[model samples]
Structures are given as structure tokens and as C-alpha cells.
Target: MSLTRRGFLVGLPLLLAACSTRTTTTSTVSMISAYGPIADDRFPLPGLNARLIQPHLRRQEVDYESSHAKGSLVVDTPNKYLYYILGNNRAIRYGVGVGREGLALRGNAYVGRKAEWPSWTPTPNMLRRDPEANGPYRNGVPGGPNNPLGARALYLYRNGNDTMFRIHGTNQPQSIGLAMSSGCIRMLNHDIIDLYERVSSGARVLVIQA
Candidate 1:
């Protein structure tokens, strides 16, 4: 989703001040090749067929199992994707929307909490940064039709505290594979719903620099 000037002005500072700690380790890359039409069940659009077909989502790079990382979820930002490293040269890849240049991050964290069609509450810090986002504060945006945190949310936590950054779904399918959120990583809503069903709370996550 393209960030409007309003969205940018509202999100920039929250993105910048967002910070976290990391434990770095190397791991093998899993290269995914082309395949037939694959249905991304997590993407929830009205009438259009929701599948990640070739060219749009292709296997470019794969990290084989690197000893340094045993149990970790890897996110390759430059590729606009996230991978839950399984083993050997295999990983479950999902397309994602990351933070724009000035708002990127690399690190390790665990899913603190998981929510389905999560309510969005712009933080006090977010409001202080942009008063225009005032009314959208406090209340969680309900699940279903129009919420931005589409189908699910895996809250990233550091040192047992919520970091405010999330790996969630987007109502904006166009935003997938683009740096266009309020710094939260966005996925096709259907894809995220599928992922939410697969991942348990406390799953390990690794965001890597490309």
C-alpha cells in the first residue's frame, strides 16, 4: 500500500524511535524455485482469486541450514519476505512489507502474543507524533472486513516486553512486498491467517539485514 503523506507524517517518528535488541547468528539459506499456482489462503480479497503465482512470488535465494541458527524464524528484508527456517535447505517463505529505509531493523525476538484480525490502537507515542491519528487511539480495530492488521498478528517482543513492531496482515494487498506501513511488517491477509494457524505463540523470529 502506498503511504499517503498523511500516513507518512503520522508514522515516521514512531518508526524511527522504535528500537530493539538482537542476538545474531548465521544460518543456511533455502532457495525456493518456481512452482505452479500456489494459493495464499491468508489473503482475503473480495472477488479476485487470491494466489501468489510465479514472477510475483518466486524463489530467488534460499539459505541452507547454518549451524549458528538452529531454531529461528528468518526475515530477509531486501527480498520483501519472511522465512520460518525448518531444516536443511528448506524454509517456509512468506511475502512481507517491511519498514522503509529510515525505519528498518535487524534482530531476534519471539512472538509475544498472537491475535486474529487484531484491533489497531495507535500508541500514545504515535498520537504525540501525529495528533491527526487521535480518534484511532485506544480501541482495537475489530476483526474481519476492513482492519489493517488483516487476519493475524504475531507481536514481536524483546526482553519479555512488547516492541510494538508486528508481523501481521494488511488490507492493502498492493502493499505486500513493499515498505509501506507504519513500520510493521505486513502480509497478505490470507497468508497471515494461514501463518497464524501454523505458528504458535513464542515462536522464534530473526530479522536479518540483506
Candidate 2:
């Protein structure tokens, strides 16, 4: 079978996903895939550059002792990490890009909704902040690999009210682990896809400022 460029890059990682400790092989491979192009994504995510995921930032289980209950999602804005609470002082940590407005959108919220290859509509503030860049897309960008919200998105809400905040995959993978002008938490497309599978609807999300 002739593998397309996307297929070759995407398949290479799955073959290596089994290389780590057997217990962690699954997570390891998934993490590796996070940096490689995706041929199976609903919208054809182009994947990420190898160097984008620094060793320290790659998805892996870490000793994260938190008061948050299991199955919750936590965003560590200052450290640029997102944790999916797995209890037992352990969690799956994924590095993310936090916008300044995303930092301002702190406190408790829940995943009121989730979507795959979700469309993106920039908030008014986002437009005002960079009209030149966001103006043409005012009508909203459709769900696809090139969209701002890449493969998956988790919408944040409180008490059934829309908080207008989101955790989603990004077309701009290079922005991971940095602050940007947008108003959401952005992850590598593959990382978001991984997160989307692990999180359930209505999972609580806590964004920590410090």
C-alpha cells in the first residue's frame, strides 16, 4: 500500500506507540501521534512539528496531587499545562497555549458541550484586538483542519450558562506553551483529540491563574 505523506507521518508514530513501557505504551504512542500528521482526523489535521512538543511538555502521566475530584479537567495557565484528573495523585498532562483573555477566564466551569472538528467564531474582543487578522473571518470559520479550532473542542459553561470560553485544538500548534491574543486554551490537534476521547460530557474544568 502506498502511504500518502500524511499517512506515512501518521503511521510512523503508531508503530512507535508500543515502544514505551507496556503499561504506558498506549499513552506514549498517543502522545507521539500528537506531534505527527493525522490521516484519520475528520478534518485532516496537518499535525505538528517535532520540536513543538518539548520533552517537558509532551503528554504523559505525572504526579499531580490536586483537590479536584477524578475525571475533572484543570488548566494550569501559568505553567501552560492542562491536566485530566485521574486521581491517585496522577493525571494526564498536556501542554497548551493560553491567551491573555483565557487567563482572565479563570475559576470553575464545566464542559457543557463537546464537538469534533468544531467551527470557530471569534468573540467581539478578539476581533477588536486584531481586526486585520480576524476581520475576514467574522462570519465564523467552518470545522476543518485549517480552522482555528482544530480536531476537537470542549465548551466551558457554568450552571447551564455559556461562559464563552473554550478548550480546543489549534491550527497554530507552534503557539503551545505561550500566551497569545485569543480568548481560549489551544492544544495540539492530536492532543485535543486525545483529550476529547478521555473526557466525558459535563466534566468540570478549573482554570488556575497561578
Candidate 3:
């Protein structure tokens, strides 16, 4: 039942073709099932509309051969895929929305901290560039389903300094696979919660831009 990265890549087209025939109800059920259950105290996350996301962007396990040790987070930015290395040449991949145009960054960082339903504040530079979009958040926005930073956030740091970047959930699930954020890596609410549970503080994160 398991496939290697090469096998997965080779068979992906056929797999997607099979999935295309699944009933809407079946797809909905599968999507909901992927999320398991939510805790009562947590913010309610909406079900992802499968139509809004590309097939490759959906969360799945695949054979991933990586030089990084198991448990490291590797982000293939150009491909818009984030891989949580599981060793044995395997990983759990999730679709992501990354920085658009000039906001992208290339570097190595670590998860300095993490938060569930974390508050968000716009950086001074962000405010200066587009006050209308980043202005209201000057005082910080409380975490919620409607918040831009969706369900969870993994703050990225480098050499003990905050990089001010994040691997966070997005309110805009449709944005998955697009380069459309200020700089933070954005994931679906369901995807992020899964990642948040798996990632720990100080986990190595490699952002491969090429």
C-alpha cells in the first residue's frame, strides 16, 4: 500500500485520474475524515472545498528522499509543497501558499515557537507599504477562524533571531499553490493543525528556493 517517491511521482497522474471519478459525497467525507475531530475549546475550522485546491496540493504521504534528517521540515517553495520528513525516504506533504513576488525568502530556519489560534500583528514595513491592508492589525488581531493566520502558526527563527516569517494556516484556502502572501508560508486550516501537532519548537526548517 506504500509507494516510494519515484513510484508516487510516476503513478500520480493515474491516481488523480481515479480520484476524479469519486463522488462529491465521497470526496467531502474523505476531506472531513482527514481532519478527525476538533476539540470543543478550539476554533471551528471549515471544511476545505476540494474544488478550490489542486489535486497535488492535497495532504498525502509520499516517498521523499531527503538529505535532511527525519523530522526536519523541508519546504520546496517553487513547487509549493511542504514536506515533513519521515525518513525511510518518506514524508507527509501538504500544499502551501508562499510569498508573492518580492516577499519571498530563501534560507534555513527553525521553528522558534508555535501557537494555536495565535494573534497576528503586521510588521512596521508591512504597514508602511499598504496601510489599508495591514493597518487594522497594528494592534494585533486575535486568533479566530476569520483571522488571516488561521488555526496555528509555527514561527520561524534563525540564529536565535526572529525571522518574522511563519508556517501558518490561512483563511484563504483557495490561495494554496499560489504565490500570494507577504512572506509567511500559508497552509490550509486542516493541514496546519496536522502539522502543528507534528512539529516541535526548534525543529529544523529548510526553505529551498531553487
Best by TM-score: 3
Better of 2 and 3 by lDDT: 3
RMSD of each: 11.3, 7.5, 6.8
Q: What is the lDDT of residue 100 in candidate 1?
A: 78
What tens-digit string does per-residue lDDT give for candidate 1 at 1-210? 211100100000101112211112211121111221224433334432333422333222233444324445677787676665546644445668898776665788898999866778876665776777655555666676577777688899989999888998777777777876666788765456546666778888878765
TM-score for every candidate vs. truth? Answer: 0.68, 0.80, 0.83
Candidate 2 contains a number of clashing pairs equal to 1
- Between prediction 1 and prediction 2, the one with superior TM-score is 2
Displacement of the residue 186 alpha carbon in candidate 3, Å: 0.2
lDDT of 3 by residue, 1-210 (tens): 112211111112212211111111124444445544455437765444554566677776665655678888988788788888777766767889999877876879999999999988999879998999888789998999888999899999998999999999988888889998998999988788878878889999988785
Q: Which stretches of candidate 1 lie over 4 Å from their true place?
A: 1-65, 68-71, 133-138
Score candidate 3 by lDDT. Answer: 0.75
lDDT of 2 by residue, 26-88 (tens): 344444445566666555555465554665556666656567789999887877878888787
Error of 1 at 108 (Å): 1.0
Quote the lDDT for 125 in model 3. Answer: 77
- Order the candidates by lDDT, highest first — what do you get? 3, 2, 1
lDDT of each: 0.58, 0.72, 0.75
